[model samples]
Target: MKVSCLIFFLFFSLFAVAQTTPTPKKKLVVVNSYTQYRAAIKSNPNNELVEIKKAIPGISLDIRYATKNNFMQQVMYKQARAFARKPVVESLKKIQKELNKKGYGLKIFDGYRPYAITVEFYKKASDKNFVANPAKGSKHNRGCAVDLTLINLKTGKELEMPTPYDSFSAAAAAKYEKVSPEAKKNRNFLISIMAKYRMNVLENEWWHYDFADWKNYDLMDIPFEKL
Candidate 1:
C-alpha cells in the first residue's frame, strides 16, 4: 500500500510540472536587411533575406521581393529597414498577399532606414544640408515606402518596366519608355496595385511608392532584431 502511494504521488507531481512549466516558445529567425545592400557586389546573395517561417509565430517571410531581370536586383539604404513596429510588418504582408493574387510580387528596394543612413543619402542629394528634414520623411523611415516592380513568380522574372530602380536620369521616368509595350504594361500594373492601397509614386522615381498616410508614422531606428 505504501508503494502504491509513492507511485501515485510521483504521477501527480509529474502532471503538476507539465501543467506549470511553460511550453517552449516558437523561435523566429531573420538576417539583418542592410548587410547585403551595403555590400552591393551585384551578386544578390539570398542568404540575407528574412525568413517568414522563422520570423513571427504563425507568420512567414513573404518572398515578394524576388525579381527576374537580374539587373533590377537593386538594394537600397542599407541602414533603413523599419522592422521596429508590428503594424509595419503586417502592412507589408498584406500588400504581399494582394500582389501575389495579381500574379506579381513586391520587389523591395529599401525599408526602415536609420536616420544616419538618411543623412548619407541627403548629403548626396545635393540638398537638405546633408540632414534630412525629419519632416519630408523618407518612406523607409516611415515604414511605408518600398521600391519595387512587378515580378512574375512562376518564371521568377521581373516583368519589363520603364527603367531600373534608383536610376537618376530621364530613363527613370514612368512614361519615358512608352515605346516598349512590355515596359508600359509593367509600369501600369505597378501603379494599379499601389493605388488600391492609396499609395503614390515619388514622381521622379518610377519605382518608389509612398503610402498616403505616411505622416502618421514616426521616424524610428529600431534594429531588425527588435522587430
Candidate 2:
C-alpha cells in the first residue's frame, strides 16, 4: 500500500513538472545584415528589392507609416518610400500600365517593411489579428507584400474602400458585405487586378496584397535606409 502511494505521488509530481515546463519556441532565421542581403541578391537577382515608384511611372505614394496618421498613431518609418522584390515590382509596373489604360492609378501605402518594425507593430497593436506576429515574420519583411489602393488617374483621388487603411474592423475584410456598393465594387476591382498580376489580397485587409511567391524570399531586418 505504501509503495503504491509512493508511485502515485511520483507520477503526480512528474505530471506537474511537465505541465509547468514551457514549450520551446521555434527558431526563426531573419537576415539582418546588409552584406547578407547583397549576397542573396548576387545568388538570386530576383531577391533584389526594387523601389516601387522608381519602377512604375506615375505611381502615387501616401506612405501612412511615415506620418503619424497610421494605426500606430506614431511615425513608424523615417522615409515615405515603398519597395518590393524584383518580380513583385515588375508585376506592379505592369499593373500600373494596365490601370492607367482604364484611367486609374496605383497608390502605395506601405511595402517592404523591416522585420524590426513588424516586432514594434506586434507589440503596440491593440488588435492582434491586424498585425503580424514577429515570431513568424511578415511578408512585408520579405519584400513580397504591398499595401495599396486605387486612384483616379485624372483627378488623383482615391477610390472608396470598405474601410480606411488599417481600420482593424470586420468591415475591413475583403469579402465583407456590409460596405456600400461603390466601396465593394472598388475593393473587388482592386483585388481582381492585383490577382491578375500574382498579388492576392489579404482576406481581412482590402488594401493589403501578398505576392504569390513570397515564400521564396527570406525575412529581412534591413531598414529602408540600408536598402
Candidate 3:
C-alpha cells in the first residue's frame, strides 16, 4: 500500500541521517602518564624537561601558581618550581647570561604548566580571553612557553612593565602603547632580548613568551612532582 511505502521511506531516511552524523573529534592530545612521558624523553632527549633553577643558578622564581597571588587567586600547583623543555632551558640560560651582564635578571612567574591546570584555568577564569581553552592545550603545557619579567640584579626589584604578570587588562597586551615611557621601553627591551633567543611574546600577555619551536613539542599533563 502507498501508506506503508511512505512509512518505510521515512524510516529509511531517518536511518540514513543517523548513520551520516559525524562523531565529535577529540581536539587535543595530552601526554598524561609518567610512563608515556618517559617514553617520549627516551625517544627524543630534547623532550626531557629540565628544572630551570638547577640549569640556570641564581635565576629568581616567584611561582604564583604555587601561591594565591595568580589570577585564579587559588593555589594551583603544589610545588614552587619551574621547568621547560631541554632546549628551552638552554635558551633561558643564554638569555639570563645576557640580562645579568646588563645589571638585570630574569624573574620567572611560571613555566611548563600541566595541561590539567590549564583546563581548570579555563573553567574558572572570569576573562576567557586571558585563559587558554581546554579544547586546545596551552603552549605552557607543551613545556615551550614561559611567563616571566625582568628584575634589577642589585635590588632584585622587578622592572616597570606595561602591566603586572597575568594581568587580564588591556594594558597587559605586549604591544599596548598607552603606557609610561619607562614601561614601554622596559617591555620592548624584554621582548627584543627574548626574541634574540627564539622566544616570542604572546600578543595579549606582556610576560608570556612561546619558544619558536613550540610546534615540535607535545602537550603534557605531567605534574611538577613527577618531573
Candidate 4:
C-alpha cells in the first residue's frame, strides 16, 4: 500500500510539471505583397480625419478639402490614423519645418491607416493585372508609412510631382525622365527631407515613404473615430 501511494504521488507530480510547461506560440503567416499598397481616397474615404498641422510643427496638409481639385490619394487608400501615431505626426512637424524654409509645405495625403482599412486595401490589391497584393503586411499596416508631397502653399496648389499619387503607370517612377524640372525640384525636396530622417520611398510612387523603424511597429487597425 505504501509503495502504491508513493508511485501515485510521483505520477501526479510528473503530470503537474507537464501541465506547467507552456506551449510555443505559432508563427504569424505573412502576406505576399504589402509593399505596394495605396488606395485612392474615393474608394477609401476614411482619409477624412480632421487635419492637425499645428499638432506637429511645420506640418501641413493640402488636404483634399483644403485644396478643392488638387487632392491626391493612393489607389488602395487604407485609412490610417496617423494622428494616432503622434511620434510620426511630430516627425512630420519637424519635416514640415525643414521644407518650409524652401517655400514648400508637406501636404500629407495619408497616414496611420486603420487595420480594417488595410484589409480593404488588401482586397483591392487582390484584383489582378491592375494592382498587386496587400495580403502581405504593409508598411502602412505598420502605421509608419506616409503618402505625401511638397505643396506650394502660396499658390494653394499641389506642386508638380512626377506622378499623381497611386499612379500605376510608368509616370509614377521616381526617375521617370520626362518629368518637368519643377516636378523634380518638388520631388527632391521630399526626397531630401525623407533621406535626412531615414525614411524610404516606394519605387513606383512619388508621394510614398516608410519610416526606417517600421519593423518595430505592430500592424494597427485602430479607426479614425477611435483615434
Candidate 5:
C-alpha cells in the first residue's frame, strides 16, 4: 500500500509539470532594413513599393493617419503619402481608369503601413475586433492592402456608404443590409469595381480591401521616409 501511494504521487507530480509547461512562441520576421528591401526588389521588381500617386496620377489621397483624424486620434505616419506593391499600383491604375469613365474616382485613406504602426493600433484600439493583431501582422504591413472610398470626380465628395471610414459597427460590414438603399447600392458598386481589379473587400470594413496576391509579399516595417 505504501509503495503504491508513493508511485501515484510521483505520477501526479509529473502530470502537473507537463500541464504547467508553456509552449514556445512563434518567431515573426519583419523587413525593416532598407538594404534588405532593396535586395528583395532586386530579386523581383514586383517587390518594389511604388508611390500610388506617382504610379497613377490624379488619384486623390486623404492619408488620415498622417493627420490626427484617424481612429488613434494621433498622427501615426509623418508623411501623407501612400504606396503599394508594383502590381498593386498597376491594378489601382486600371480601376481608376474605369471609375473615371463613370465620373467616379478613388480617394485613398491609407496604404503600406509599417508593421510597428499595426502593433500600436492593436495596443490603442478600444474595439479590438476591428484592429489586426500584431502577432499575425496585417496586409497593409505587406504593402498589399488599401483603405479608400469612392468619390464623385466632378464634386470630389465621397459617395454615401453604409458607414464612414473606420466605423466600429455592424453597419460597417461590406454586405450589411440594414442601411439605406443608396448606401447599399454605392457599397456594392465599389466592391464590384474593386473586385474587378483583384482587390477583395474586407468582410467587416467596406472601405478596406486586400490585393488578391497579398501573401506573396513579406510583412514590412520600413517607414514612409525610407520608401
Candidate 6:
C-alpha cells in the first residue's frame, strides 16, 4: 500500500540520519587510578612524576596550597610537595644551575596539581580566567606546568614580582607594563630564564609556566601520596 511505502521511506531516512550524525565524545581522560599511573610510568619513563625537592635539593618550596596561604584559604594538599614530569624536572635543574650562577634561584609555589583539585578550584574561583576548566584539563594536571618565582640565593628572599602569586589582579599578567620598574625587571627576567629552559609562561599568570611538551602527558588525578 502507498501508506506502507511512505512509512518505510520515512524510517529509512531517519535511520540514515542517525547513522551519519557523530556521537558525542567520551568524557576527558583523567588518570585517577594509582594502578593506571604506575602502568603509565612503566610504559614510558617520561611519564614518571619526579618530586622536585628530591631531584633538586637546593630548590625552595613555599607550597601555598599545602597551607592556608593560597587563594583557596584552605589546605588543598596534604603534603607540602611539588612535582613534575622527569624531563620537566631536568629542565628545572638546568635553569636552577643557571640562576644560581647569577646569585638567583627558583622558589616553587605549586606544581603537578591533581585534576580533582583543579575541578575544586574551578567550582569556587571568582575569576574563571585564572582557573582551568575541568572539561579540558590543565597542564598542571599533566605534571607539565609549574608556578614559581625567583629568589636571592644569598639572602634567601623572594624577588619582588609584578604581583604576588595567585593574585586575581590584572597586574598578574606576565606582560603587564604598569608595574614598578624593579618589579617589571624581575618579572621579565623570570619569564626569559624560564623560556630558555622550554618553560613558557601563561599569558595571564606571571608565575605560571607550561613545559613545551605538555601535550605528551595525560591529565592526572593521582594525589601527592601516590607520586
Clashing pairs in 6: none
Question: Model 3, clash count?
Answer: 0
Sequence-dependent TM-score of model 2: 0.89
In model 4, the runs with Cα more than 4 Å from the true position are: 1-54, 62-84, 125-132
Q: lDDT values of the candidates?
A: 0.54, 0.94, 0.95, 0.60, 0.95, 0.96
Q: Which is the leading candidate under lDDT? A: 6
Residue pairs clashing in model 2 are none
Better of 3 and 6 by lDDT: 6
Report the C-alpha lDDT of model 3 over 79-186, residue by residue, as the tens digit. Answer: 999999999999999999999899999999999999999989999999999999888889999999999999999999999998888888999998899999999999
Tens digits of per-residue lDDT for model 5, 1-227: 99999999999999999999998888988999999999999999999999999988889999999999989999999999999999999999999999999999999999899999999999999999999999999999999999999999999999999999999999999889999999999999999999999999999999999999999999999999988
TM-score of each: 0.57, 0.89, 0.89, 0.65, 0.89, 0.90
Q: Candidate 2, residues 23-50: lDDT per residue as tens digits?
A: 9988999999999999999999999999
Pick out the ten consecutive residues of candidate 3 with the lowest summed lDDT: 23-32
RMSD (Cα, Å) of model 6 = 3.8
Model 1 gets an lDDT of 0.54
What is candidate 4's lDDT per residue for 1-227, written digit by digit as tens? 99999999999999999999999866544322222122322344333223345476445554331232322234333232234244455567677777777777876766665555555545655333323244555666556778887777677577788877666667776667788888887787677788677677777777888777677555655444443
C-alpha RMSD between model 4 and the true structure:
11.2
Q: Give per-residue lDDT, candidate 1, residue 30.
A: 20
The parts of candidate 1 lying over 4 Å away from their true place are: 1-91, 125-135, 177-179
| Candidate 6 weakest lDDT stretch, 10 residues | 24-33
Backbone clash tally for model 6? Answer: 0
What is the descending lDDT order? 6, 5, 3, 2, 4, 1
